[model samples]
Target: MLSLLGLLCLLHGIWAAPGDLHSLCYDFTVIFKPVIQQWSCEVQGKVDEKSFLYYNCDIKEVKPSGLLGKEIQRTNTWEEQNEMLMDVIDVFKQQLPEVEPKNYTIRGPLTLQGRMSCQCEANGLSNGSWRFSFNGQIFLLFDSKKRKWTVVHSGARLMEKTWVNDRDVTEFFRKISVGDCRRWLENFLVHWDKMLETTGPPTVVPNAFHAKATTIGPRLWTLLVILTISVLLGT
Candidate 1:
């Protein structure tokens, strides 16, 4: 089984950048079992390598994490940003089942991980991308410039086809990644320096796992089995 800690390590490796590159990234993980009717989700936001905000599905609220988060909450656009994130969660919840593999029987829960990032270089260049993973293995990537979906794992081919053909869904992803994400990053950058001055060194905890090894929920064990089936069947 791929532990939550391992999954976070994978994400950090993908988002790691040079000193001059700044990024605003959101990491979302959702786990659910239709059988038991139990589900949970977590959304985390980071600027560069520092985590600033977190949302818990259990509470349906966004909470500021540190000094940077407090400052961000004070901004006039914070409310709007919060609402946008909530909407994103709602969309994901609605869409995930639409792409689920047909005639595939799973013994346990399902895990879906999604990441959206907007990157800015010191030279005024900017770009954005979205990635989705089923059970910890990345299966889909979005190219903002080309407006296309790249399927990494064949199991996700259906997902890519469905999303690419749905103009509304594709445009929604584009607008958030290319437009709103960039604007939010720029706004956050305005307060970046001052906030850093008052805070400690940047600590990147993509999700709740920060230690070498930690206990995770039972549902996480389903990841490896599902991943294996996904790879073999190309669902």
Candidate 2:
């Protein structure tokens, strides 16, 4: 039937959506806490094979991005963003020393949604936490079927990762690497990537509940029996 066909098509379409992200890199969301209570970042949107575009978010800043710098193990507070900013600029100056520290505001609250977790080197990993910054707090939500990458994870399959908890958020950074701007960013993002895994929305099949009126119903059953008898007699 047309109705059944349409229903099938709708389900198929939702399943076929394209966004399959690998857990390699990341994008970040930075906030000017307390007074402004706003956060934004430089990276956003679907990333190409080579690099990622900038995007931002307005979610809980439960943890800092670790994009600009690694958060040290201490009491967390809103006042630290500016200090983090200064430290980041110092690292930045070391790398591209010619670049002066200017107040660069975050772009906007983008929807670069992905798994929210961390992969620290202290877990007995080989490399130090200095390899994934260029792609910090930024990873794509990829669709395996279509091979397309998207920034937002609204309908896409996600890793069941949540940043709601402070413990999980703290793991996002280790060592507070002011080592170098580029390498430091990579280190933070790599751990974030490791934290990304398939936490699903749980796939389910579509089905029709009621196809038609049942003959077992009193009125319908009587009508069918009478019609059958009449047909038999007439025949």
Candidate 3:
């Protein structure tokens, strides 16, 4: 009886603990290629619920021998992280023109330092389903009502949602394969450049690399997992 009680307690504690991530770090450098002029921007950020969230944006060689950069630091709760990232991006958008207005240069091989958290339950949309695609190479169809996470590429399935832990979800992410992701990256940049050139560039081009979109690569995708519940038990 004592053993049974202890086992139950252990199971509850595990479920109550925070999912893998305490902080998330993203760092990448992009070199936009153009004939007349070129642009290179490096964005780095560290975000967490308890610690200070920091973002550094660096624009190098906007003009011959010119450099521009900005840094932001703030602390926020886990629930606030999604909004925090948007605010940082907005700040970068506002600052890009100061560096240089005319140039098209972008390259990837972006990086993520820690686990990325996604919450399916937060949407409050009962039984909603969404298609998750990465550069059109990898796809996941998540059925919130059914609590099903499917791997479109491999035809693998996580049959039970509550029983699914970080390790189980992470394995599904790996099945998409890193090679496919690299191909996606190359294909995406080609189309992206064409759109930019034709559409006359966006209002602000900071050479931004979105962590969620870029997660097709092994380095980034490996860190992806949905934290089903908030951190109820402190580690």
Candidate 4:
């Protein structure tokens, strides 16, 4: 379960983004409990808050979506992105046992979800973060710039300590967040720019306009909202 402090922090983090920033994020979920069936993993990639690709571990394939997906597939980084996601699956499998809650008496279904994001501001500044949640409760956060982990829940303290002590794991997280993710974001931005140019600028409505916009909400916001509701429902 997420601590009160952790919930507040999560809410604050999601709403603190700048107006002119662009972000690329990868969200992955791993199922761990209800042990009668095979465990599964699913990954989704979003650019500028829209999903462009999906990877299912069972199928071991990357599936692209829409015109943006078609454009991304033509890039050199497409293969690299596939390989990186596969690596993420392997890392999650290896670390799941270590991060599992040891003292929780209630047992049913359990899940581990990770979201890694790279954000670029209009002025060319870039940064990234990695967040992990267990059973829909945010438990850990990694700041790429600081190369440090913050444990959001008390149950996750040991997991944080263990990961911090592992030099290889620490470096792997740092490299992926600050290096690979940022590079991939930059590459995707080039394609996104072209797509925007071809489509023209988005139509804007004045504040006085009462008509509802058709714009889709961000994937991160939807996920976080669902998680928050689940927490409130005590499910």
TM-score for all models, in order of appearance: 0.74, 0.20, 0.20, 0.75
**What is candidate 3's lDDT per residue for 1-235, written digit by digit as tens?**
2222222223222322223222223332333333434443443433222222333345322111101011121112222433434443443333223222123133332221112222211112112233432222333455434555666644222222222455554343332122222222223222322323333322432234422333243332222211211222222
Clashes of each: 0, 28, 7, 0
What Cα-based lDDT does every candidate model obtain? Answer: 0.71, 0.28, 0.29, 0.72
Pick the winner on lDDT between candidates 1 and 4: 4
Which runs of model 1 end up more than 4 angstroms from their true locations?
1-19, 200-235
lDDT of 2 by residue, 1-235 (tens): 2222222222223322223222223333333222344434333212112232232333323233332222221224223433443343333223221111133244433222222121212221211122212113332333322323444323221211221122322232322322222232333232322222212221333332221221134344335534644554466
Model 1 shows how many backbone clashes?
0
Candidate 4: regions farther than 4 A off: 1-18, 197-199, 205-235
Clashing pairs in 4: none
Tens digits of lDDT, candidate 4, 1-235:
4433233334433333334467888999988665564578999998877788988877888998776777788899999989889888788778876777778566666678899998876444677899988888899999988997999989887678778898898888788888888788767654544555444434543332212321323444446545774675485
Worst 10 residues of 2 by lDDT: 126-135
TM-score of 2: 0.20
- The C-alpha stretches of model 2 lying farther than 4 A from their native spots are 1-82, 94-118, 121-127, 131-175, 178-235
**Candidate 4, 133: how far from true, in Å?**
0.4
Clashing pairs in 3: 31-105, 31-106, 31-107, 32-104, 32-105, 32-106, 33-105
Worst 10 residues of 1 by lDDT: 210-219
- Top candidate on lDDT is 4
What are the candidates' C-alpha RMSDs?
16.5, 21.8, 21.1, 13.5
lDDT of 1 at 217: 26
